[model samples]
Target chain A: MLKPLGDRILVKVDEEKEQTVGGIVLANNAKEKPQTGEVVAIGTGERTPDGKDIPMTIKKGDKVIYDKYAGSEVKYDGQDYLVMHEKDVMAIVE
Target chain B: MLKPLGDRILVKVDEEKEQTVGGIVLANNAKEKPQTGEVVAIGTGERTPDGKDIPMTIKKGDKVIYDKYAGSEVKYDGQDYLVMHEKDVMAIVE
Candidate 1:
């Protein structure tokens, strides 16, 4: 299993970007990739300056919207994943 | 100038990814973009829980190495830039 360390969170991006306004597939040649994804795993929370463990707000299975390029992309088990810091995550999806 | 607001930092990625491993230009079809850059600009300090301004550790013109794919790429003024949060910044290079 691919587990991210520290404040890194592993995201499985939802690949739903397949249409365009003109009903043509958008140019993948320049697209920066998707930003929305489901949390497959989360790293341990950050340690406070006082050495206390700050619990992470996000959990596994939480759908999140992050910056499009805000993480390291890695390949594992024939699947692609994004390892991002918690702060890079912008909002929690409903 | 492309000034990133909040904890966002603007990085001018060093375009040093034009070499070959075996003297053959690596395949651009699957390789990710570069991960090293110079901090062209940095965001304001983060707000602490007590409302104090926690100063940012990074400064402009500092060379930095960040996780590959860990920022939103934007084209502004005919140049490429990455907008990444402070926490996404991994290490400061000399």
Candidate 2:
């Protein structure tokens, strides 16, 4: 288990679901990779100039959509993860 | 003047500063493109599921560092700009 530090998050990307139209199966690569993910771990919080903690809005296990190009890729234990600042998250999916 | 909508911001990217060691000049491309920028325009806020607004943390004229891979590039008035979510801004440069 990886623990992130300070305003960072570990995201497990959601795979694009298969879609078919008129009985024709679409190639998996044809669809853009979904920017959605499940948050696994989060950092404590960002610090203000005065050293106060700026509370993070997103929480662990929150399903989130993020900027398509945000974050860095990390491979661990044969799995891939994206570590991003909480701000890279664009929206919380309903 | 483009007014961003909904928690988005326009950033003017900071150029990579030149570096020298022992009077040897380094190629500009040898250095990574800086992730810092000056905020220009900002969106009002992102809305909560219940229609409440989540005010933006980053403001116009603030110098911020963002994820290198974040944001989309646009050329406006012959100048380059990046449009990104406020969250993508990792830190404010003091």
Candidate 3:
């Protein structure tokens, strides 16, 4: 199992959409990188200057939107995951 | 003054560096867009599903690293500023 440390999270990115709003077939080169993903794992929390733990509001299985260039990309067991700090997550899709 | 709305923030990006760590002069086209900036203005907070406001931890004048494509770019009085969600800011440069 891959466990993240220090407020880091692992995200499984969603599949890319091949068509645009106008139904144009965008080539792979023209497709904008996706920013949405499903949370896989997360750390407990981040430590503050006072040595207090700031608990993360995000949890596993949440659908999230993250920053475009936020995380370090890694492939584990043939699956792609983005490992990034909790701060990079934009919002939770409820 | 430009005021941000609903967890949005305005950031002033730092100047671009012309040289690399290896002392190579990088041209404008070769330079990667920077992710670090100083906070300028910020919204009060984001409302929760229950209608509670979640105050932001980021304040004006803070130096932060944000997602590369996270914000909308705007020029205010000859200065370049990025308008992005607080979530797009990855970390505060303390």
Candidate 4:
């Protein structure tokens, strides 16, 4: 259970299934596609110049979409996760 | 003289001289190097979550160094300019 700092978020990346066409799996060499994940943990939030907290838009268990190149990858307890700023999240999957 | 928007600063790029060695100029294809510029105009500032102003660190007439891929390029009055957020500026050259 890693606690994120500031406006950072810890996300558990969802396992993406390999794409297959005609029963042949396509190799994904370019990882530029967007990724989806579940919010595992969230930081307190960003602070204003006056030090007031800015409320986070995403919460725990929320399914979010983020850019491929955004965030740093971390492995904790044999699990792979991404730690990124809240701004890296593009949208919440309904 | 284009005015920048919130947190954005307008900068006039300093012309970089071609690298010459032994009276031969070397062509530079990779533009990943940082660049220097003179600040021209700036936005009022960014707003806090509660709408308070976050004062800008850089001001007009300041010479600054910024990331190579930081901003949008603009052409104004036959002059090239870059409009980027103040955060894009790495430092001010004294």
Candidate 5:
């Protein structure tokens, strides 16, 4: 039930098994691995310089790929979610 | 004569003496030290989601303070300048 603001979106990060190699733990935060998430909520879109509201392209329930280091991590009701701007999202999974 | 694009602005970085202490030099790229520059050229402003162009707040010859690590370095006429988005600018010095 988290609501984002200003072109930001609330996302539920998909969980995946950690990758390891030869008894070495690979870093999970590398830039090469883009994260996927399900959009839970969206903001009211970004405002134009003239104070006009711009509509958002991505909608709730859409799957999206985002930048590795995008968004702020927020814990809501014992669950973790990310609140990031729309620009951080690279593409929609369709 | 480099013009920025999409809410980006070109800046002429002000030259200052590098700080040195006890034969040790402090890293010039620290976040605490915000950089100041004069606005040179700016892009046509960022486009709204509906394809409308937003007007820029900063103007040419304005002295502005920007984030330490903001923008890309470029050389024009053998002088160093930064090309960065307007959001990277913290404030305009009056």
Candidate 6:
């Protein structure tokens, strides 16, 4: 399990395609991978340039929506994960 | 256009339903909305509890993925938008 640092978060992406959602059964070459994901871990908080602490508004187990193309992607323990800043988050599910 | 402040970011959510990905034509009640979005705007950066400045890694025009349920959604000019901390961002698109 990868733990994010700072105000960064780690997410496990949900599969993009499902049989119920599709009709054509597109092959892997044509299938588009889902860029969306679920929150797996959250960072401690933000740090000031001067090394001060900034409180975070989000916590673990929260679902969020963000820009499709943001943050850094890394593979750990044979699984793909994302690590990014909290500011990149855009909305919370109700 | 909505301007995000601090480490907050604004995103324009893409529609969850698309013909290419589905077959059943699930009704609105059964269809799941896509929590993912595109970055429309970005905040200046993060602020320390003491009010110091913290540089942000993400910039405007960057796409990202975040927790499915992580931000505040606001309607501006009849368009839906999300505002959240940058730390909430989990990944950046290559």
Best by TM-score: 3
Q: How far is candidate 4 from the true structure (C-alpha RMSD, Å)?
A: 10.3
Runs in model 1 lying further than 4 Å from the true structure: A20-24, A28-34, B1-94
Ranking by TM-score: 3, 4, 2, 6, 1, 5
Residue-level lDDT of model 6, residues B7-94, one tens digit each, is 8989777666554435656445463322556788887776778677677766777766656666898999999888878767655544
lDDT-based ranking, best first? 4, 5, 3, 2, 1, 6
Clashes of each: 2, 1, 0, 0, 0, 36
Per-residue CA lDDT of model 3 for B2-65, tens digit only, reads 9999879999898865766578785666534436789999997776676766667678998876
Positional deviation of residue B8's Cα in model 4 after best superposition, in angstroms: 0.3
Residue A84 Cα positional deviation in candidate 6, in Å, after optimal superposition: 9.8
Every candidate's DockQ is 0.05, 0.03, 0.02, 0.04, 0.05, 0.08
Model 2, range A1-94, lDDT digits (tens) per residue? 6655458888998876668889888876644554999998886686444434578888899999998888776555677778888888989997
User: Per-residue lDDT for B50-94 in model 2, tens only?
Assistant: 676666767789887666788999899998999998767655554
lDDT (tens digit, per residue) of candidate 5 on A1-94: 7779988999999997678899788886643555778999999889878787787767899887666788999998999999999777654554
- Per prediction, the TM-score for chain B is 0.80, 0.82, 0.83, 0.90, 0.83, 0.76
Angstrom error of the Cα, residue B18, model 6: value is: 3.9
What is the per-residue lDDT of model 4 for residues B9-77, given as tens digits with 9 covering 90 to 100?
999999988889999998895744567789999998888787877767678998876666779999999
| Number of residue pairs clashing in candidate 2, backbone atoms closer than 3 angstroms, sequence gap of 3 or more or interchain | 1
Clashing pairs in 2: A87-B87
Q: Which of candidates 4 and 6 reaches a greater lDDT?
A: 4
| CA lDDT, candidate 4, residue A46 | 71
Residue pair clashes in candidate 4: none
Model 5 regions lying over 4 Å from their true place:
A20-32, B1-94
Task: Give the CAPRI class of candidate 3.
Answer: incorrect
Per-residue lDDT of model 5, residues B16-69, tens digit only: 777889979888764468889999887667767676679999999999999889
